[model samples]
Each structure stands twice: as C-alpha cells, then as structure tokens.
Target chain A: MLIDTLITGLVAGGTYALVAMGLTIQFGISRIMNLAHGDTIIAACFASFVLFSVFGLSPILALMIVVPVGYVLSDAVYRIIMRPLVARAPNAGALEVDSILVTFGLLFVIQGVLLVAFGGNYTGYAFLNTPVDLFGTIVAANRLLALLLALVFGITLIFVLSRTRWGMTLRAVSIAPENAPLVGIDINRAARTAFALGGALAATAGVVVSMYQTFTATIGVIFTMKALIVVILGGKGSLTGALIGGLLLGLVETFVAAYIDPGLTLAATYAIFLLLLILRPTGFFGQAG
Target chain B: MNTTVAFILAAAALAGLAIAPLFLNAYGIGLLVGMTGYVVLASAWAMFSGPTRYVSLATVAFFGIGAYTVAVLSETLPYPLVLLCACAIGLTVALIVGLSTLRLAGIYFVIFTFGLAELIRQLVTWYEVNVTGTLGRYIFLPFEGIHIYWQLLALAAATLLLSWWINRSRLGLALRAVGDDEVVAAHAGINVSRAKLMLFALSATIITLVGAIQAPRWVYVEPAIVFNPTISFLTLIMALLGGATRLWGPALGAIPLFLLFEWLSANFPNYFSIILGVFFIGIVFFLPQGVLAKIEGLRRPARKAPPENKERSGAA
Candidate 1:
C-alpha cells in the first residue's frame, strides 16, 4: 500500500513540477502571470483528444503538432495582446495588474472556444492502461509515460537554463532586466520567447495529463490555481525548488487522502499554503531583499 | 447647492427603483434583481479594490460564507438577526485574511484571493459531508423575489452612497495615497494596513449581506452553487469595465454588461462565454480604464489627462 501510494504521488508530482516550472519560467522573464495558462492546457487536451479519437494517432505523436501550435499561438497572443500592456505599464506592479486583467479576458476566450467546440463534458481517451512493474510496484503504463515525459521536459529545461549561453542570458533578463539591456541584450525578445516556451511547456503537461486523467472545459481555473500555488511554494525563478515543492505537495496530498479523509486533500493544501505564506513569504528558494 | 442637487437626484433614482416592481412583470423584476445584486457586488468590490489596487478574488468565498451562515441560521433565527450574524462573520474572516495576506505583492495577493474560494468550498464540502451528513441545504425563506429586489436595491444605494462618501473623506485620501504608493503612504503617517483592513472588512460585510439576501433565490444552498468562483470574475470584470477608480463605475459597467449577458445567454447559450470573452478582450484593449473613464475623458477633452494616469503614480 505504501509503495502504491508513493508511486501515485510521484507520478502526480512529476506533472505538477512541470506545470509549476512553466509558470515560473514565464513569470521569471515576462512578469505576466498568464491566467489563461490552464486553458492552453485544456486546448491541448482537446486537440490531443481529437488526434486520438479521429486520426487514431498516439498522444505521443500528437505532442509534435500541439506543442508547436501552442508556442506559435502564445507568441501571437504576446505580440498582439500583451506587448502593448508591457509597453504601457509604468511599473512592474501596474504591468502585473494589466496582465491579470487581460489574461483573465484571454482565459474566458479560450474557455468559451473549448465550451462551444465541445460542450461542457468530461473528456478522456485511453492510450496505454496496461500495468507496468517499477521496483516490484504495479503502476499503469500511461502514468509512467506521463512521469517519464515530465522528467525529460523538466530536465531538458534545467539543462538549457543552466548550461547554454542563451539560457543564461534569459536568466539574466529574469534576474535583472534593467541590467540586461545595459549589457546590450534584447530583453523584449527574450521575454517573448520565454513566454512562448512557457506555453509550450503547458502544452506538454496537458498532453501528459490527458493520457491518464479525464478533463473538462471548466477545470482549467483549478489547474491554474494549483500551478500558481506550486509556483509560490517553490519560489520565484527557481526550477529546482518547484520540483521539490511539487513532489512534496503531491506526497502531502496523497498521504492526507490515504490516512485521513479523502476529502481533506484540498484542506491540507490550503493549510500548508497559508502556513508557508505566513512563515516564509518569499518562499523556500527565494532571497530576502 | 451642488450637493443638494446631487442628493435629490440620487434620492429620486432610488425612489424610482424602489417602486419598480409594482410596474414591471416577473421577468423584469427578476432581471432587475440580478442587475441590482451585481451592482451592489461590483460597487462593494470596487470600494476596496478600486483605490487599493488589490484585485481580490475572495468575493465568492465571503459571499458563500454569508450564504451558508444564513442557510444554517434562517431556520432558527429571524431574518435581520441572520443577516447581522452573516455580516459579522464575514467581517471577522476578512479582517483576519486581510491582516495576514494583504501585505504581499499585488500578484501574490491576486493568486491568494483567486484560490480562496476553492479552498473555502473544499472546507465547506468536507464539513457538510462529515459534520452535517449533507452536501446541500434548502433555503426556504418567507421572502419573495420582489423582496430580494428591494433589499438589493437598498444595498446598492447604500454601496454607492458609502463609496461616494469615502471618495470625499480623509480615509479615502489615505486609501488613494496607499493605492498610489504604500511606502509613501506609510511615510506620510497613514496606517496603510489599517485603512486596507477597514475597507476590506467593510466591503466583505456588504458582500456577505448580498449572499444572505440572495439566499432565497437559490432555494437550495450548496457549496458548489453558492461558491461559484465565476462570481469573483464577473464582479471584477464589471467593476473594471466601469472603472473602479471612480464612484458608480462598477454599476455603470454592471448594468449594461448584465443586460448584454442576459441577452447573450438567452440568444446563444452555447456561444455566451465566447462572446463574453471577446467583449472582455475588447474592453481591455480599448477601454482599459472603463466606460466611465472614456466618457469622462471625452466629456472633458481639454483636461489634458489620460484616464490611466493614476497607474503611473509611483511607478517611476
């Protein structure tokens, strides 16, 4: 039972870690909290659903199509909707407000499209439900696939972010945008690329998530909140922290549901979130100014 | 002389709305009731969020709490007492939450408030299942739809009046200063937290009362029904569309948008959210400051001030 629960928790945590990393990357450079991020996930889920149900393509194959679309669409969104707000916003706080409001509108647009295209229905498609053994523990193959994909995406991001010169420049932009321009780096282009990359990560998570779990049109906001919570828990601009925090959150939730009451999962999440805010407002990997 | 004219005009408008149910059919009354509810909700939300610039998504949480309070108590207590308890409970919760979380940056607070409804809904669901052995409550009050309308109308008037009064008071000045810059407000000897807490609690109380008043409309009280997270979004949009920075801005946004939504829902139910989304993006792109701001700007073109100048304060 312990092994089963731990495996389940880790699988869940892997997806969460990827989702949080996407948000942190976008927020790190772009400074725009994309409220519609989960909608992008939902859109990809629907797209993947269509690919499987109609074209009879595997979700793994669907990723190739959906991810690039996600990147391009998000880039278009930034160019059309967000660029003006970024330019007009006099300060970071004002930009935050404008982004929240605008993305809020964007959230509804995406949700509305999903709702109209596919009525408010719970959607799912089974890909690989066969059992797999990992360390003598039984787990579904789809879930394992999800875990592996999340790890690959997350690790690749960390590598690129840490090792490459371009990634370092992006990090520098996130860390000190004012200084980046002084160093002759084009901060605007870097921020846009980061935002689009974040959207692509969301698309990746969406495909991975839909492989195992059922989803609905209205469930996007809940995912947004969950990702936002993980981002706050992990700390700003810290991928590794998001990884640890996401896994911890998943374990905590699973344990609470298993030992205590299943209904207490959300309550436990809130309790820990509130406690963390009160105790360490900057988060685990955050620096105090 | 200006005050008297303004007061008389407001009074006449209130009187007109108060007697509206007598002339209108059930449909009109129902429409007005919803519009009035949003008016109060958006206005009350604007009272704190407008000047403070803290866009709170906890509106549904407090509103749901007030609804639950009434749902549990309306059977045992009188209507007025039930309302009072709901208000008191909402105020307490708001004070505690505001004290703890309002100090965070704008984005953090927005996310915190965004998650608050879901958290409260989960807790409520747990309590209902474990403690009460039920997930829903039936609120059968001795109140008519017209009664709900009148009460909401009175509340809307009160919200507007209070907002107007605050706009002229020292607290309003302090709140504006805080909204402009928290550090400067603190340096200027304004107790920033106190001002924010007071308004937060006050607005929360009104929102609670709205939930209490509208309980009969639902008839069945459940965490899912009462704690609809969309309420927060709707209220925020209405307030922003109207421009929270000004008195009556939310109402101006709420009235037209509410009517438009009603029409859209009726005409193209499936396309309702889609059209609404398009409308929201249009507003953010064009009338970012709100309809009132656009109107006021056009009305006084020689003022040489853009509507969003307030956002520029302390940004440098």
Candidate 2:
C-alpha cells in the first residue's frame, strides 16, 4: 500500500514539476510572477479536449499543435503586457509588484475568455483505461504514461538548459541581466524566449494533467497556487529544486490524505508552506537574494 | 487640494451618502450599498499596502473571517458586538501573519499573503465539510435595506476618515519611508516592522468590519462565497485603478468600477467578466498610477514640471 501510494504521489509530482519548471523559467528570467500560468494550462486542456472530442485526434497529437500555439500566445502576452511594464519599471524589485497586478489582470482576462469559449464545466479525457500491476501495487496505465512523458520533457529541459548555448544565455540573463548586456547577450530576446518556453511547458503539463484528472476553468487558480508551492519549496528559480519540491509536496499530500482525514490535506500542505517560509525563505536550493 | 478644503468636501459627501437612503429606491440603495462596500474595502486595503508598498492579496481572508464570524454568532450575540469580534479576529490573524511575513520583501511578501488567504479558505472549507456537515450558514436578521445601507455608509465614512488620518499621521510617514526604502527607514530610527504590522492589523480590522456589516445582506454565508478570491482581486484593482497612493483613491476607483460591474453583471452576465478583464488590462497598460492620478496630472500639468528643466529653459 505504501509503495502504491508512493508511486501515485510520484506520478502526480511529475506533472507538478513540469508546471513549476515553466514558472521557474519565467520568474528566474523575467521576474514576472505570471499568475496567468495556470490559465495557459487550462487553455491547453480546452484545446486538447476540442481536438479529441471534435476531430478524433489523440491528446498526444494535440500537444504538437497546442505547444506551438501556447508558445505564440505566451509570447504575445509578454510582448503586449509584460514587456511594456518592465520597460516602465524603475528597477527589478518594482517589477515584482507591477507584474503581480498585471498578471492578475491577465489571469482574469484569460479566465473570462475561457468561460466565454467553454462554460464552467469539468472536462476530462481517458487514455489507456486499464490498471497495471507494478510489483504488487495497482496503478493506472495513463498515469504511468503521464509520468513517463513528464520525465522525458523534464530531462530534455534540463539538457537544453545545461548543454545548449541558448540555455547558457538564459541563465546568464536570469542571474545578471545588467551584466549580460555588458557581455553582449540580448536580454530582451532571452526573456521572450524564456516566456515562450515556459508557455510550452505549461501547456504540456496541462495536457498530462487533464488526462490524469478532470479540470475546469476555475481550477487554474488552484493549479497556479500548487505550482507556486512547488516553485517556492524547490527554491525560487532552480529547476532541480522545483523537481524535488514537487515530488516532496506530492508525497506529503498523499501521505496526509492516506493516513489522516482527507479534508486536512490542503491545509497541511499550506501549513508546511508557511513553516518553510518562516524557517528558510530561500528554499532548499535557492540562494538568498 | 488643501487639507481643509478636502475635509469639507469629504464631510459633505458623507452627509450626502448618509441621507441618500431616504430619497433612493431599493435598487438604488442596493447599488449604493455595494459601491460603499467596495469603497471601504479598497480604501482600507490602500491604507496599509499603498504607503508600505506591500501588495497584499489577503483582503478576502480578513473579509471572509468577518463574514463567517457574523454568520456563526449573529444568532447568539448582538450585531454590534459580533462586528467587534470580527475586528478582533481579523486583527489577531493579521498580527500573526504580518509578524511572520513582514520580514520578507517584494514577491515573497506578496506570495505569503496570497498563500495565507488560500490556506485559510481551504481550512474553512475542510471544517465546513467535516464538522459542520454543511457548505455554509444562513443568518436571518431583522434589519431592512435602509439600515444596512446606513451601516455601509457609516463604514465607508469611517474607512475614509481612518485613511485620511493615516495619510496625515507620523505612522503614515514611517510607512512611506518603509515603502521607499526599508533599510533607510530603519536607519532613520523608525521601527519599520512594527509600523508594517500595525498598519496590517488596522487595515485588517477595517476590512473585517466591512465584511461583518455586509454579511447580513447576503443572508447566506459560505466559505466559498465570502472567501472568494474575486473580492481580493476586485478590491486591489479598484484601489489601484482609482490611485492606491492617494487617500481617496480607492473611493474614486470603487464608485465607477463597481457601477460598471453592477451594470454588466445585471445586463450581460456572460460577457461582463470579459469586459471587466479587458478594462483591467487597459487600466494596467494605460494608467498604472490609476484614473484619479491621471486626472489630477492632466488638471495640473505644471505641477509635475522639473525644476531643473524649467531653469535650463529659462536660461536658454
């Protein structure tokens, strides 16, 4: 039973890691909180739903279409909303507050658009509707598939960040944009690219999440909060931190739900979040700013 | 813009609002009551977050607690006492939260407050489900629409007065100093953390009172309804839109936006949110300082002229 729960938790955590990675990129590079991050996820889910239900396309195939769309949409959002705000900001610190307001507005706008496009109703997709025995525990095949895909995407992202010149450029910009410009790195281009990548990752996570569980337009905010918990727990802009944080959060939540009253799960998650903030605000892998 | 003139105009407006219920119909009174509620919320939120530069998303948490307090205790206690209890609860919670989070700056502070609200909402939902066996509590009050309207008006006036007082006080100066640069404020012998905590508690108290006063009008109090994130977003937007930095900015932001919200929700319920979303985006993009500030700037453009530029131009 414990192993089964652990496996389930890990699978759930995989999707969280995907979403948190997107957030970390945006936050690390641009310093924008991107409250609308989960809305992009929701939009992707809706897109996948339409493709599957209307066109008889697989959700995986939908990803090929959705990812590019996500990239463009997020790029547009950055250019239209965030770029102007950043230009007007007096300093990096002020950008945080301004982005919060602007992204919050963006969240509402996206939600409203989704609501107009698709009413407030739960939508889900089932793939590989079979339970497979892993060792002695039973697990859903689709969940395993999601886990595998998340791992692939996560590894690819890590590779791109560590082994690619573009990744180095993004990292340099994130760490020291002022210095990056001194070194001839295009800060604006790096920021725009990060946002686009973040958007794509968000959409991929959304697709996996919709397959795993039901979703609705209203759930975006909750998902955003959860992703934030993962981001903060792992350490503010650390990819490895987000990955580890996501898994740990998943395990804790799963264990709490399994052993204690399920109702306390969210409360417990937030309690740990608060305690972490009080004790070590930098998170496990984060360097104190 | 003189303090004395502003005070007189504020007093005249308050008097007008107080007497409005007599001449207005039920719908008009309802609209005014809702508008006043937003005014109180936005202004109270501005009191702490405006000068301190702390962008708090926890207004809904305090508001929810107050609404729930009234919902649970109104049957057993007097309305006035229940309101006071709500204030006390809000203050206590804010004090605890502010002490822990006030040390963090920028996005950390913002996230902490936002997380605190979400945590409280979830906890309340859990309690309602496991202990209460019901989603919400309903209160039957003996007050009419006019009484509620008067109470709302009084709350609005009180919030406005408190905000005005804060803007004029030493605390406000300390808060502004903290907002401008916390280290500088600390170096200047101001107890920065204490000022933040006090302002947070005070803001929470006023917001709680507004929630308590407005609870009975709804008759039904649910965690989901009272603790709705929309309240936080709307209050913040209204305060920002009207000019969060100014004393009367929130009121200025609330009246028009609330009216538009009411009109759209009533007439085009489906498209209302879309319009609001677009409006918010427009405001953020075009007028980050808020509508009132924009108007004020337009009205007195010469006030913003750089002294150096003026002297240089004169010499040229």
Among the numbered candidates, top TM-score falls to 1
Which residue pairs collide, candidate 2? none
C-alpha local distance difference test of each model:
0.87, 0.84
Q: What is the fnat of model 2 with respect to the true interface contacts? A: 0.40
Ten-residue stretch with the least lDDT total in model 1 chain A: A280-289
Per-candidate DockQ versus the true complex? 0.62, 0.44
Runs in model 1 deviating more than 4 A are: B307-316
- Cα lDDT for residue A132, model 1? 91
Model 1: pairs clashing at backbone N, Cα or C within 3 Å: none
lDDT of 2 by residue, B107-188 (tens): 6667767767778877888887988788789989897778887888888888778777887899989888887777788899
What's the TM-score of chain A alone for every prediction? 0.98, 0.97
